[model samples]
Target: MEYHPEPVQQLILCCSCGIAIPPNPANMCENCIRNEVDITEGIPKQGTIHFCRNCGRYLQPPNYWLSCELESRELLALCVRKLRGLSKVRLIDAGFIWTEPHSRRIKVKLTIQKEVFANTILQQQFQVEFTVANQQCDDCDRVMAKNTWKAVVQVRQKVSHKRTFLYLEQLILKHRAFKNTTNIKEVRDGIDFYFAQRNHAIKMVEFFQAVVPVRSKSSERLISTDIRNNTSNYKFTYSVEIMPICREDLVCLPVKLARSLGNIHPLVLCHRVGNTVSILDPNTLDAAEIQSAAFWNNPFSPLMNSRELTEFYVLDVEPLGPTRGKLMLADVTVARASDLGTNDTTFLVRSHLGHLLNSGDHCLGYDLTTCNFNNDQFDQLDAGRIPDVVIVKKHYPGRRKKTKRRTWKLKTLTKEQDELVARKQDLKRIEQDYELFLRDLEEDPELRANINLYKADDARSVMTNGGTDMDETETDFPEVQLHELMNELDINDEPDEAMQ
Candidate 1:
């Protein structure tokens, strides 16, 4: 080969000195190559087989046993990200794998697939899970704050680290605590930022409603509102099957009011940060605590005896479960008027709070003896009574020890007499209408085409003329009894002869 010196630009430089090396293949200076080979010599290339979709490890980590935990974490994380976006999250083990009844957070466990050692391929194939959680915030890596979310996850088999499993489990706990703490800090900071400088007030208020859900039964008045300004002064009396929400999700809130845009409650702060929630309103707390009908009638006091407690109001809520599973709907209100005598009322209301159903469910403390009377009209219709609905006022004795006037609200308490008035009014209107129809029929032969008029007349006639004898015309139904008592009404003879 003609050895014309190659252009200097193509020359290789020595790592030791700035001198150019020969123009051979990958021409590092001979000194640099020798040094690299010496440093690289005798190092064993260790590799792992099992690869997790999450940690990408062949071996599963401890405390990541239940698939439910993993699922809840992933799901809660994802949900938080979507709704609140990159929010801090807290996850606590309610000590059991089953979802906590009153928990608003999803619960899941991590899953580990078995490792299939492939002798044919000459490498062990560690099959791991790529399972993501549902109902969780994936981006935020936190759980949700629903009333309850119970999800379970079962792995293929046991983990290999039997020796250090206990230690790892503690580590997991620490991690969870840290996560909850950090989240709480972020939430508090966010609250400060979110509710920053604004008009000053002695104390701003927030509302918290307690809702009970029952699978069966329906009501019209499902929601009732009670506003509370003081949260630190009182706590909601929520009964649970297991444990109630603790300091983690419910922290002691500050006395000074932080400015807010009124978009969300401050109680959500603990939920956002450390699983510690600070509820804002006093009135809402009172209402939520009064889940027990007994409590509603007589304010729970350490000093007052049961006999000393005021008048009665029993909630006919869903039956209590073995534990706190039976939750009373918190939305329904006591419809009786305070001015009315003991348990004397025309109608009561059943209002909704958090959900559509006015009934309680198997989860929390729901008053079982109280019957919410939205209005008797709906029930009356089913009982085969006349169709008319109206609210009647009633009074109840003083609920507070000091106040004596009374509390008054609408209730659906209808006596047979009340219903009778409704029926009689309905019948009288129909009779007048029928009388007009007959006159019109006589006036215009073209009106004969109206079969509806005939049907209505026939139905009304049958209702009035129960028997062939004209004396049987006014037989009594449920609504008629009250009218008879009040008005001394008598049943006239049946008017079948009039039909003839």
Candidate 2:
């Protein structure tokens, strides 16, 4: 192959400045072109940034408010996007400039590149000063004006205790169902969730319907109306009444309903309360579900609750070997723990918790023999067929005066307390209900599956100090596995000082 050398092209003179430059369409020097054609001419050097002092959010034009730190990429992007003609030039680089926090000013340095002439590119840098202006967003304005909510969801359960409500709150927090709620208020027997939009409230109601059996009715109050525009402003209220049934409650089903549910007994224990009420017959170990519609159509209250449970000492337990899941039918002879020293009042009964019970174990039961009946169904039942004692569950002894902190913790929503002062007895009852709920979480693995259990801050210390009081019979206490708990991360809300 023959070696060849390329000839050097001749340089042309600048038309306007009379300087040598590469051949191009404009026929001008780089300095002259830069002076004549300014790419950042229309882009503003100073602009105003609308910020909500209350929420610490920056307003995006039109009607969107966003949360961003002082010198974050989000804030830098917001500043860059506000310029009118920045799109005309290609953005090479953009960053934040440090400024005093009290000055209410954000400075952004932008480097842009643009083609000024044929085969010629011009790059330039400019600083944009954005003064933070105080502005209240629509949501904040409504809150300050005391008309903050467009819709409210009132969740209530007509029960003696707040256990069901507390469980529902945990479910809500786990699924982030209250993320859209503007405010949460705790009432005597229920919770009120306020939303800024009707759709949010509707979504919340749907969530309640999916998680538990609930009967809801909605009503709206007209706030104002515009006749010419055919527009009316109204506040909507969704009264969602949860099923009265709760876990551990004894329900006395109607004779007709009981026959319909696979020939189950009228007296059944509520094993679980979810989208449907799960009831199990302690005598037959037959389980059935009562849907929301079915339950409301034939409304029934709990014949008895945990408050009515009496501690009984199991003298004997003989399993019949008939099994249904974890339950087994057994004949048990029990004597009331309270009457152990006073009298020998022993009663024979059949229970489904035979798989977990043993001789000499303590259990909670209902003493139907001495209780007076008020319902027609109870009066109709044959006196001989009804058991004298019905064991509910195994009783774990050694509960401390002050609750021992657990290795795991649960996240709860921030709620406003009722205006009326809570009675001392009511507060004590609430505490007892909470303690019972915690015990349920420990014993029921399926129940805790839906919840996010975080590792407590002092978990190691508590564990070292004996996390829970141990009973002589260790099998009675169910411990939660450590692996199932997640370490809680602390999120910082303040802007990073080193970002500058």
Candidate 2 lDDT over 1-500, as tens digits, reads: 99888988878999898988878888888789888999889899999999998878898887778889988989988888899998788999999889999999999999999998777789999999999999987656645543478999999988889888878888886677776667778888899988889999999999999999999999999999999999999999999999988898887898888888997888889998889999998998899999999889888888889889999999999999999887899999999998988998898899998898899889998888788878877777767778887788888776533445667877777777785417777788889888888888887898889788888888798778663544445544777889999867635322211111
Write down the TM-score for model 2: 0.81
* TM-score computed on alpha carbons, candidate 1: 0.15
User: For each candidate, what is the lDDT?
Assistant: 0.23, 0.84
lDDT score of residue 286 within candidate 2: 92
Q: lDDT by residue for model 1 over 329-383, one digit each (tens)?
A: 2322332233245554422222222232222111111122242334322232223
Q: Best-fitting candidate, measured by TM-score? A: 2
Worst 10 residues of 1 by lDDT: 200-209
Off by over 4 Å in 2: 1-30, 36-48, 59-74, 77-103, 112-123, 137-148, 222-233, 341-343, 400-404, 460-476, 486-500
Each model's TM-score?
A: 0.15, 0.81
RMSD after CA superposition, every candidate: 31.0, 5.9
Clashing pairs in model 2, backbone N/Cα/C closer than 3 A: none
